[model samples]
Target: MAGRPTIYDVAERAGVSKSLVSLVLNRSPSVSEASRLAVEEAIAALGYRPSRAAANLAARSTRLVGVLIDDYTNLWFVDLVRGLRTTLGEHGYRVTVADMATAPPTENPVEGFLSMRVEGVVVAMDVPAALSDPAAPPVVIAGTRRAAPPDADSVTNDDAVGARLAAEHLLSLGHRRLGHLTASGGAAVVRRASFVEAVERSGATVVTIEHDGPTDEQAGFDGAIALLETHPETTAIFAANDLMALGALGAARQLRRRVPEDLSIMGYDNTPLARTRLVDLTTIDDNSFAVGIEAGRLLLDRMNDADARTGAGAGATSDGHARATHRTLEPDLILRGTTGPAPAAAP
Candidate 1:
């Protein structure tokens, strides 16, 4: 049986100490360039393969990061994960993904991540209260506003600004009675509030239809049906997400309501679904890739400094302490085929 190559073999070949070989392989900044080169040459000559587990134990850290996502089927989530992988890979970290698609709502994803001994965790779902463990590894939450504990961090697009932009677009098109189809719960409420505020500022009446469940095509369809039925005067609708906006499009088609001519609809998240030739939904670009990239960077930073304070592990703070270090990206409106000038009033 062949034995594994040892660091001593590399050190002997390079004419360096075992510590020098270890430092080079572990990427320690303290090692000189000449020393690092010698270690690399020695490693090549000896055909040495470093043991990841042993290296982690020696350094008291690991390069593995665990990412938890709400739904794997959502293309936006897929893109976000891809962005995270690309960024983390550049930093010599491997990502382990866990899809909580079928998990019960009450299950603690953070606990699962902890079990893996992940140095850091990135959550692409709504923030969970159970993640408030100061002793745990750092965490980064995306796509939701639930504040991380003092020890965790988070990254999100400017959802309120995105909603305002969508509402303003309709208002600019002379939409008076505007209706909103939005997801239920925390993030949706913020978007709805922004939309209503924007409409109110423009002296327009805002009628909102809140979905009973998660934001999806079904919610969009059902919400649109209710809104159109209750407020026939509504000339425009702004959905919280592209999926819901697509649902609104389906509802309009079913009712024989000509788009842009009879109504204008806009959505957030500017996902690929909105760009389909069949749908062509006008939407606000939340830049999901950028969000993922930022989240990945935050995780890397945490890994670099294990003692750093993050929002996820710190729990609720006083107003002053709770001031979230949120990174809010601006949203741009992409006008496609769905949004247009408001239809003229019926003769």
Candidate 2:
């Protein structure tokens, strides 16, 4: 078997000392441009891949970030993770993701992240208070600002504004009696509240159905059935998330209600599914990718500062409670085929 090439091999090929090769590979700014180029040339020629583990050891940085998500089936979560991966990859950091399927009850996710010795963590779910430990590494919440721990930083969409946008769209279409399907938890609750507020502000009435289940197709469908049964006068429905919105569409079909003609529907997240010709759901674009990017940048900054503090023996401090830093990304209203002016008022 052939032995793996090491820094020594690169040094020999580039006619430089092993220390010089190490310095160049580590991106030491002190190395001359010529030396850096020569080392790179040799590395490319040898088809060598630098050992990230070894590099991390030498630099005292794991360069690993942990991401905890509530569910993986949702396309919105998938897109957010993709955004985080892209941004973190650009900064030379890898992500370790954990999906706590259907709302984790314990702190195992936090424990798992801590066990990995990740430089930082991005909690993409509404983690319980018990799950948040001050002793753990820096943590940031993504998606909903409502679940942000007192001591944790967060990035969220302007859900209130987004909800209002959806409400306004429906109202503009002459929707009067409205129904909202909401997921359980802080984010969903806030969005539902905003929707109700918008309806009231616009001189309309809103009937809300809270679903305490995963924000998936099934939950949406079930919620829709109940909502329609209870509020037969509802002319439009707004789902807290896109997945549920799709479910609601399915429920409407089962009840023989034609979309836009019999009812108008709006969903949030504006996921890929919403764009499909079959669904064509009018939704609120949360700009999830931008949220992921911002979260990644925040995590990196926290890691770098923590690294610097530990190196200087200054001890790292938590930013979770240093003045509620909430970042609300703007959301846009996407009009699609699912929503239209309310059908001519029944005779």
Candidate 3:
């Protein structure tokens, strides 16, 4: 009676079996609504907490997945994780995330997951050369343009198409002198190429396409300032990502340029920042959530394939040599307060 509440105590108090309580705790959809509610109420009243360490030991498998991301402050990854959990949780898998931005320069971040014996790994950041041949768990790359690993799958939005959409929208809004704020990366290259092509096709002048240091607000702000200083005729600016677009907003305010009056700003990724009242940036929706879902689905497929091959006496190393898959989801333009008809004359 003097011990911490356990699942047994919760089951007895709720008048339910331990297995039923476990199912409810696991969030299995098969459990009846009434039974689920009863178990939840009992656990809440008794303050019973499940022992993850004990459960992992008993199951003989961690049922854990690792997600490697570049920056946690970037809200695009937040949606990607939400989508991954939506699908992964249904299969009794839990995700543990690591920020590569904070890792030691010489260490391979994925090693942390491998040491924990994760069932799979999802890479939302650029894949490093050190992790090119991760042998065991299935791998999936999300929201990246890099080619998949030998046996991995990649899911991303079409950056080129999204960029073209942005360009065309700006052109339609009477933007004749346009600028692009970008950073160095494969995705950035594609977006810049498409944006340039669209501007040329529209018979408009591309005033500037600045390659900022990093894809962040500071880079965006610096690039925007540079564009404004060098090419004051630029009426619109399209940033490679949402964070960069926010930087453009700062530059506009600092330069005494009214948004959608003196300059129209466009950002990509349609992150939460773009939708906020303070930073209503018009941008391309990369559909990162869908990309995450696709990555999770592909990883599940690869895992299932491995299980099948193992059951048929195939070796664990065999799947890594299998053919890889590349899936691209479509992106769309989202209109907001940041972008509007170009100014009649540049101020």
Candidate 4:
């Protein structure tokens, strides 16, 4: 009457029970022809339209979204999840994460997510080879390019730009002798490659130490020690991530080099650790929160398109599978106390 008509109004107008009206709306065969006609007549009079969200509810929609990550120790996921949850929660979905490092080998993380009946998935790490199936659920990959499935939408950082920013920063400070501490991963490889190229373009020296172990503090420490010991003239260091940069700080301390006075260090990811008063690490801000928001939007689009193809409650019409989307965000440099002009050489 006052606003949009509801099922309750339709039932009251049709002189039937609310349950019977629902049965008609959902097209249940149990409703008699006479009752169906009565409901249709009542609906035509009131112009009642069912909500897709309500329809999904009646259809037993799961309303859950799963996120996959390699580990929890990486603080970079903190802001990413914040942005992701903000977007998905507004659309009536909850986000759940699976740490692949802790999952048993027998049960694939994707399988675990599917067993939980998640309507969609967001992969913040590498896309596993086992997930190349054609019938896989809707997915959005974050920060991966090479391993991304054909149908999965992707959101990634502009590693070339980010690495260039790092290189230019160090070079601007007169850091001719540079050292890079990195680990194994697609993101790491891209960053390392770009950083090396940018430094090489200026005819500067770059000593890269790639650790075979996990990308953690210890790897950073070991790599830094090796780099500094082998390239003692190296005046600047760039770590792959904030955790590694923190480890580099420790390495510098153990080696008796005063930060930004005797040596300058920079890191990537601009994680919360870089913002701390103690660490104060100069790093590249990958804009991961924005990447997460865009990723959430992309996954929603994929899920909605998939639903339309299967005649789901969400309204849309398309003939064939939707095309995948790929988005990349540019990164910025955050200056802090960790980096400075190259110190005067021993004279």
Output the number of the lDDT-best candidate.
4
- lDDT tens digits, residue span 268-310, model 2: 9988899899999999999988888888877765555444333
Between the candidate structures 2 and 4, which one is better when assessed by lDDT?
4
User: What lDDT does the true structure give each of the candidates?
Assistant: 0.75, 0.79, 0.80, 0.83
Judging by lDDT, tell me the better candidate of 1 and 2.
2
Worst 10 residues of 4 by lDDT: 308-317
> Candidate 2, which segments miss by more than 4 Å at Cα?
1-60, 102-107, 145-147, 315-324
What digit string (tens of lDDT, one per residue) describes model 3 on residues 234-309?
Answer: 9999998998899999999999999988899999999998899999889999998998888888876665444333
* Model 1 spans with C-alpha error above 4 angstroms: 1-62, 104-108, 307-324
RMSD of 2: 9.1
Query: Which regions of candidate 4 fall more than 4 Å away from where they truly are?
Result: 1-58, 105-107, 312-322
* All candidates in order of lDDT, best leading: 4, 3, 2, 1
Clashing pairs in 3: none
What's the distance in Å from true for residue 192, model 1? Answer: 1.2
How far residue 29's Cα lies from its native spot in candidate 4, in Å, is: 28
Root-mean-square deviation of each candidate, in angstroms? 8.7, 9.1, 10.3, 8.6
